[model samples]
Target: MSGPPPAAVTVHAPLRRRVTVQGVVQGVGFRPYVHALATALDLSGNVTNTPEGVVVEVEGDPAAVARFCDRIAVDAPPLARVDSVHHQEVPATGDSAFTILASRADGPTRALIPPDTATCAACLGELADPRDRRHRHPFVTCTHCGPRFTIVTGLPYDRDQTTMAGFPMCAGCAREYTDPADRRFHAQPVACPDCGPRLALLVRRADEAGQPSPVTDGDPIAAARRLLAGGAVLAVKGLGGYHLACDATDPAAVERLRHRKARGDKPFAVMAASVEDIEPLVRLDPEERALLTATTRPIVLLRRRTDGPTVPGGLRPAEGVAPGSPDFGIMLPYTPVHHLLFGLPGDPEGPRLLVMTSGNLSGEPIVTDDAEALERLAHLADAWLTHDRPIHVPCDDSVVRVCDGRPLLVRRARGYAPLPLPLPLEVRPALAVGGDLKNAFCLGAGRRAWLSAHIGDMDDLATQRAFERAVAQLESITPVRPRLLAADRHPAYRSARWAVRNAAGRPVVRVQHHHAHVAAAMAEHGLDGSVPVLGVAFDGTG
Candidate 1:
């Protein structure tokens, strides 16, 4: 009756496949994630990092292989960004176990590197646990967290290509690096105090042009805290660059830092030791709190608390912090060094909050070069709390605010950079030099677009050079060679001029401000001219 009783279903033979995953997969615990995924599916084969991206081979039941491919994209590591995944079936091999192989140089160069992440909770717990060998280690990092974009020198992110290359892992760390069950199995930045970057505190000499000398035979953290508590301004090196830090509660210190830096009434970003330290100062909603504690650890702009018990110094938000603004930029300690600055819990001597502003003269790039910092910041900083780790590229902290319960990015850099944004429409290999003011360039290939970390005003020579270097770095990772270029139409804009100068005979398209905004929105909404939609835009100048 039904049409010859439906044909019997057929079962397929065991299948094998090679999957190439693109996007921010390297340096992010991705190999271990793939290893775990393959083992769980009872698949056999291996995963490896390649210039193009992560490559995985699996042989198993046809269904299991299919699920492995699907889950790899869906259940990737938190920091892994799966842009485009391609898989093809191949002849099955009789492999018994899955393994993570050493990275290979041969392949397409489309792998994205992850941004530097804040210390993970597990690492923080280990830091606080006295029994852990790495307790209070300033460079404590596992596969789950720590430096990524800031420390990486090249693609196929490995220890050798990173700043950590200089520091060989200790025997204890070596075991964890090779242990598949360990959290730090292949973490590139994995290190202990025995082999890691060292910190030092240098006090500036009275002679303005003289080099600062190290404080004699004292704990650097303790010495730095003492200097800060005494209202001394310090140039503290951070993940990307140096930050001029001082006790936020000290009105005179804040004023001094502001005056010396030549900053005029600009609200400074504050780094609080913990949520408990800032809860009384800012009215944090659930969204704000999550943002404050997120792995990205961006400076979140929050409305100041109108009613609360004053902090130890009773420093009002409007008094010395955010002067006319209703909101204050607040960030929690993201690095172990930052946590150490406040001292261990139950210690009441250190400052609970610090004014963590970028270390630079007005209208200049943030200082990354140690020698440059010494020379440029001599007048502003009373001492320098720095380390031996070299910063490859200078990235400023990203700034964000919550609007209608969602994060609104004001400045995207550091923790949120080197990650691609999805493009609704496919475009040729192209580079878009953003506005000269905010100056965030974009590299596009196929359907993916990578916006670089915020590059400050292009008017400064150092910033322009930083922009070019950032573009080159992004190019190495994105594999998006620009056959076409786009830039703002403002004839006088420096970024536009840069685009023209660097086009290298490639076609350059000039786009108007409003037109570019509309087109971006259209692409984002997936409108391919088949339907019409109303759009509205408001510019700051308007």
Candidate 2:
């Protein structure tokens, strides 16, 4: 009736477009996604990773090309934040297939790196499945989740630029890494038990003159669990830095660690396997639960429960863990190592709750160097559960609390550093060295500002050196080149002194402490200062 399906008419002529997508696109499965998208649309072209961003060329029907451009940013991967997408029409290539090309490092690095994310659901399932090849693998990861900002040393987000460079992928891993259909395609940190980081348990031996020695017998995770159950303190290396962990239910262990670390009644954060495990100790509102389970995996502070279910076998959090505090800071396992430390299914029972705190003296930066951790934590931990992967940046755990059903950031580091905060107005490229107490600096250019991770106090030389390193690293990854420096007006403040020393001929702007606080509040609220507003600033120094 339709003239025998007359000659398969083309609704639109073939067209091509070159597309550029910016923001957190690299190291998060953007290329494979593009391949799948183009294949579905019957388009021909290629996708490539560049320091500037992702570049894609698609030649297909004009309507299909328009759809691709529209959906490129809208249907981006969960971890990939597409800030901008620009495309231009070009001559059609008349090709038949879409392909992913190797990463090119031939442009200025403008792509933003994503923060480290917790293990995704897929990887977790494989970890617990006995039939899976990655079962019980400590460093199991995929494109959807795993280390990002901490492991990355350069742009273009390739494996060779990460700490995993030394551990080449096995044939099995290589297959997954290359297969676009696989979840791990282009995952920079992808690995398996055959070729990846390995864990070792080092215990202090009396015969070895109190020096820690490797326990080559049995699984390191199992050995570490046994030590924890026996009221031992452990120095456990994590994605960011070292954490001093002990059984939270053991009153003796908690007191011992407090005394050793010189923590005087300051509350310690605790890590549990799930929300159910911590419900008896803290009140879990819906918002608090969400924050605890979020991919960021920050320590959520919750109100303490006065009367709750009884936990057997002395499994309750010790009073010494958070004495005189009405809230308890709790977080779930964010890494495979932490999950194994708490024991997986069919594994020997271990401590369900642990008091996890920064592995450092009372007021020093979190220890990242392996040898330094062993030396500095000798008196703090009875055993060392560490790996070979180097931590390029020392990021402490982030802390959050829900106030009025809204989350408030108490300390932003591991999960939320180097991410730009959109400013209400543009400003010249500048650096602001914060006060000496908290010592977090900011780098700003245009309408974005990036706050560095918590850099510790500036009272000691070690922290000063750490500050310099952090500044250098942050500058390398960001586009900000400070043309102006800002510091507090306190003449003798160590932070101010450091800013002046490193101004390098740039003018230093000294602002009053309280005035800076009020201005920051205004800026955070997106106030353009066109209207007068009353503000009250309160702080110990102010």
Candidate 3:
């Protein structure tokens, strides 16, 4: 009786669709990832970066379209972590093929900005190849990986909007950057040895023309190794800003850097060579190692090793690194220069890692300019290990710790800021002037919150200028024009004054400092504020 069961029925409709893939898409290798997928599925569409997310108008075989839309998150790049993909049928414009278009500026910016990533394996191989023009070049990078938030002045992350603007790519690099097949395709920071950021060794001389010292000898790596081994202080320019470094093993030099910076009892952070170096210094399980080696390159605060013998004393490597803090802020090198710094000639054994800290006194912003660093940190550092690469924006180092089983942001700077924080309420255009200490600004519209990089504090004229600059630069990226400004009610808070002074037509909302902190947490936790909340208040004013 069931001879033919039932005739199979197929439903077919020529449907076109528009897909918006959101959450952490920009600078996390989303375009290339989508490009590969679109090509694989034989889709006829174009993908572009809008403020909210990647916009894709795919028109193809319905089955392939389904797979292309659904499988994106599953097949995302190792660095790209997609949170959601929304697809809806739309009137199709008959396009022949799928193309990745340049990012658009007017759309909603609900997507997160990605932090600077570590050098990719491909770039690393080329770093050592003599035939490669980028051989031993410290700033080698590609589209898949390189500096992101820190170096970027505005969004749509083109070379023109980056620190790489001054040093345009040469003919050879131009070809590579243009080629979709090449790794450097759309790499904003692409450069060759011919047209690239170069390093310079500086000494504080009476005249500017007086040649300090050329770091470029037969081998700059070897030269850096020699310079570092001699117990001299080196002021190094890094991802976030400038760093003052000294031999960790040499107590005297470490002591000197600490004293000169007027950082009396504060802890000094140490940059280690490997997880092996990290293990001997701090107790680490697999989780700690994983966090340390994460692409963010944040300063992971770890518990000090109580049992290790020959531990450096009151140099207090652990305590000094995170002064007045409960954890030790440790990090590994994130750049090729760092890799080669540790990989010196003959494999010398003088503790490859050193004490690396912000090149400034406590409570000040990081020094970016060589002349400024020399003038400000002259007494702090004996010598300088600077590069000619001009820093477009100032971004301090990010410090993190696992608190209450979650990654707590102690110092959110270069690696973490400018990323859009998903907001709970879709509020009007508003600017939140963050706490004066560990200062940053949050500009919000709809569900997106664009946080400025670490702007030191609202204390000095320099920091105030920096805050203004960061605000101006970030305003260029977002579509929102703030209608209101928010600041802490603290009497002496300079941010409050700045908000009052600068927000001309906007009314300022005065939120209590600790209340804002609690509110921020409650927002992230998705807790309703209608009911009365209980909490222990640590106002720090007994």
**lDDT, model 2, position 473:** 88
Residue 158, candidate 2: C-alpha displacement in angstroms: 0.7
* Residue 208's lDDT in candidate 1: 67
Cα displacement (angstroms), candidate 2, residue 217, comes to 1.1
lDDT to native, each model: 0.85, 0.90, 0.74
Misplaced by over 4 Å in model 1 are: 1-15, 40-42, 60-67, 206-209, 312-318, 346-348, 513-542
lDDT of 2 at 402: 92
Q: Judging by TM-score against the true structure, name the best candidate.
A: 2
Clashes of each: 1, 0, 7
- Pairwise TM-score winner, candidates 2 and 3: 2
Give the alpha carbon lDDT tens digit for every residue of 1-542 in model 3.
55867888887654578888876677666777777787888888888877777888888778988888788888887666687888899987778877878778675546565677777778878887777788778889887677877777766556676778999779999998777677676677888778998876665444556535454456655655676778777888887678988777676677777778888777777787777666656667666677788777788888866685234432334233445654566788788877777873345554556888888877777888767877788777766777777776777777888766678777666566666777777788998988788687898888777877777756767788888877887777666789999998987788888889998877999998778878877766666577777756566521
Worst 10 residues of 1 by lDDT: 309-318
Identify the superior model by lDDT, candidate 1 or candidate 2.
2
Query: Which candidate model has the greater lDDT, 2 or 3?
Result: 2
